[model samples]
Target chain A: MEDQLTLGGRNFSSRLLTGTGKFASHTLIGPMLAASGSQIITVALRRVDPKAPPQDNILSHIPDTVTLLPNTSGARTAREAVRIAHIAREAGCGDFVKIEVITDMQYLLPDNHETLKATEILAKEGCIVLPYVMPDITISHQLYDAGAAAVMPLGSPIGSNLGLEMKPMIQRIIETSRLPVIVDAGTALWSNHQPVCPPLYLRLLFQPLHLLRVQCGYRLSQNPADHE
Target chain B: MNININGEAVETSTPDILSLVRARNLDPSSLVVEHNHTIIQQAAWADTLLQQGDTIELLSFVGGG
Candidate 1:
């Protein structure tokens, strides 16, 4: 069991990297993070809460144990993705960057062309680029050659909870790539496993948490100490 | 000659790696060189060949936040 994964010289203890987009409130996010036992927390660089006044800083509540993983979510092109990475790096994110060039809003699929080009460029620029690409073996090889620190291949569309749709390719990627391979996006198996929240906002939610439970359960049961 | 960085004009001369970087007047620590869109490793920068019309983008990783 790999307890901590090192990317670009930074050590992270948690394998579970949780996204902060869907959580109802900042108050809940902290507890959920604790519940999830995730050390790596993903945050979108483009979307900042604007309704709150400027004086109120939203980033205060996030615990220090959480290793901030700033993602390039909204960018459509390689240039735009690089620009976002630059801003995040400048904003004290250290050298880590999650490259996600999502061109389709509905599918939330990464634009393969843009992703490869950007990863190559950023790797040259000295930023540790972890790209979220579709399950393409050729792209994976190109990414490794391009100097990516890691490859995050989507299981399904973003937020779809479709666990490892491209199973064979993902397994192949995991086997072949020298870098850490994280199965990112569409791993929403939390609805059933974690029990339904009593809140009205979540009442209509039909998310099946069982998928997430199995994934976490297998990981935790195999090596409980790894979770620590 | 397009531009002279240190003292030597940018030319097609296949100079030694140290001489090439030295002629460019670039600090190896501050800047990263990407020639022809491929990132030149810090260790290999001196040995990397500089051709005429080679598109180089210099990137600086500095402190922020």
Candidate 2:
């Protein structure tokens, strides 16, 4: 038997999804994707800066083999998120859209209500919606009912580097949800010291915990051993 | 004509979307143009003309999580 993660009628061999953010240089992205073996990568859409110097397009760095998962990061409302999703699809970024509706700026906690609303609308629009929400079992079920392809619950606040702060709640969600549960943010394995385990090791460790998948947003180091 | 591009008002004599992009020295293949809140496909850029007070947005993929 082979292990595969399926989303939106497509099968992916690697369960780890990577993001194209916080990188020191765009040159590191290609090698990082190659090393991580991530089949799906997340990107954000923004207005082109007119004053900025001409540079290589971010899409040019990403190989055609990988799937583009464009996120609605800047949206604060369901309507805004829906608009971004439509634009992303029309821009030829495929059907995958990650619904991230954050209104709380201080802690950057996701507004579950707006996220659910966006999920409902985008899913109905034939998008493969993956909503990032707070770790709530009821909300997970609601997302599934809303036709979401997957439910991404945060382990903690975004980019807090606090690994699995809401582990118990996330565990409950993973246990009950029929949809794929992806641990999206605040699961970084660094804290002023060298990481105890590599990313591959962490993936194997997560098996007993029943974590379906994980998305990492760490910068890729030159040395394979120097895992962030 | 004056138009709103990415929330900034700009003055230009460029007629079509393609010409406007060229005038700004932007790569057409690397852009997604939104005219008056509707995404205009690259293939239609040559046909989609700009109008005064029209809102245009030039979007591209960026590094984000």
* lDDT, residue A124, model 1: 96
- Cα lDDT of model 2 by residue, A77-167, tens digit: 9999999999999888999999999999998999999999999988888999999999999999999999999999887788776777887
Chain A TM-score of each model, in the order shown? 0.76, 0.90
Q: Per-model i-RMS in Å?
A: 13.3, 1.5
**Worst lDDT window (10 residues) for model 1 chain A?**
A206-215
lDDT of 1 at B15: 51
Model 1 per-residue lDDT at B62: 26
lDDT tens digits by residue: candidate 2, B1-65: 99999999899899999999998999776788999999998889999988999999999888888
What's the CA error at residue B29 for candidate 2, in Å?
2.9
lDDT by residue (tens digit), candidate 1, A39-143:
666665432222422222224545887766677876999998997787667555667788989898879889988999999998998988888889788888889
Candidate 1, which segments miss by more than 4 Å at Cα? A47-56, A190-228, B1-65
**lDDT of each prediction vs. the true structure?**
0.60, 0.82
- Global Cα lDDT for candidate 2: 0.82
Measured by DockQ, the strongest candidate is 2
